[model samples]
Target: MSLGNTLSKYFNNRAETSEKHWDKDLQTHYYKTTKDKGLAKLEEIISGSSEYKINSVSTDHGEISFHVVKGKKAFVIGTVIMVRPYQTAIDFTVTTESALPFDFGYSSKLIKKLYERINKDLPLLDKQN
Candidate 1:
């Protein structure tokens, strides 16, 4: 591996669990569902993923927050906000518990995977609506 890659891995392995890199590593997604339904679907998608484990959930103030553990090294904080009657916004921040200052792009990849799953699952929800 390149020097940068090796260094990233080393740092990531040593990174602190309590530190969150949200300032530079955050993703947002928009969905066409009500706030309540969007929160429910978000919970379902995260819970259904074998790679993620739900840590906590809160629904209040017109938004939902989810704390999830992704795999063994990463923690993900997801928020669902009601933007309009039929529009909702989902935001995710992923942080790695390692010594490294970087996660080798794991955070973005995790967000993408989550987005894909939610997108794919929406059709099923639509069928039931």
Candidate 2:
């Protein structure tokens, strides 16, 4: 990672996963599952954790929003979209709640941690870089 990218992440309180993200961990991930199945897996993973409190789930919109209330407070949104029959894409948006200006990359680390857990439940086809 370049200094610019690293510093940006540290200086920001939010991080989002996208196909063209510079950080590999922040890149969009694809799973070998249907949209509903993918969403269910994510729901299970997040809801199963004591670190998160689910705010809402919308299967129609393919999105799940939640709050991290155990440790550092943050809002998280997971988006599950099935691009093809067996190819689904999941992305995350995390915003850390802190008294300071930034969470020192906490939001990014949270996304990475969530991805790690989700990878165990769903088959990771590839990372969409």
Candidate 3:
């Protein structure tokens, strides 16, 4: 094969591989950023608010106290599991670990679609560039 043709073929293969790597990296970064933003937004909404009161907060793990202190610091003081049955055999379980009250921000489909949209080289199976 001519040198020009060989070089062209080599460059094309490298570009395809590099493009795949970039797409994967971008997706991972997007997820990380989205998760962080969602958590931050949840914190912003709940913390330093009267809605999440200390006395009224009851969970299956335990009761918690929301302490608002020193400018913008808010801390939750309580157990993770609270059971309040009111003398009944039925148990009200408040396990914060399993309970995610915050938004996850991006759906998997959305993220995938986003990755496709921003990626300069996609549909690698039909790659011509």
Better of 2 and 3 by TM-score: 2
Clashes of 1: 9
Q: Which has the better TM-score: candidate 1, or candidate 3? A: 1
Which pairs of residues clash in candidate 3, taking residues 3 or more apart in a chain or in different chains?
60-81, 60-82, 60-94, 61-80, 61-81, 61-82, 62-81, 62-82
All candidates: CA RMSD (Å): 7.8, 1.3, 22.1
Q: Candidates sorted by TM-score, descending order?
A: 2, 1, 3
User: What lDDT is reached at residue 102 by model 3?
Assistant: 23
Give Cα distance to truth, residue 86, candidate 1, Å.
Answer: 0.5
Model 2 over residues 66-97: C-alpha lDDT tens digits?
A: 99999899999999999988999999999998
Model 1 pairs in collision: 11-99, 11-100, 12-100, 13-99, 14-98, 14-99, 15-98, 15-99, 15-100
Among these predictions, the greatest TM-score belongs to 2
Cα deviation at 121, candidate 2, in Å, is 0.7
lDDT order of candidates, best first? 2, 1, 3
Off by over 4 Å in 2: 127-129
Worst 10 residues of 2 by lDDT: 120-129
lDDT digits (tens) for residues 14-95 of candidate 1: 2211112332223355667887787788888777766667777777744333344545467766677766666676666667
Candidate 3: residue 109 Cα off by (Å) = 28
Per-prediction tally of clashes: 9, 0, 8
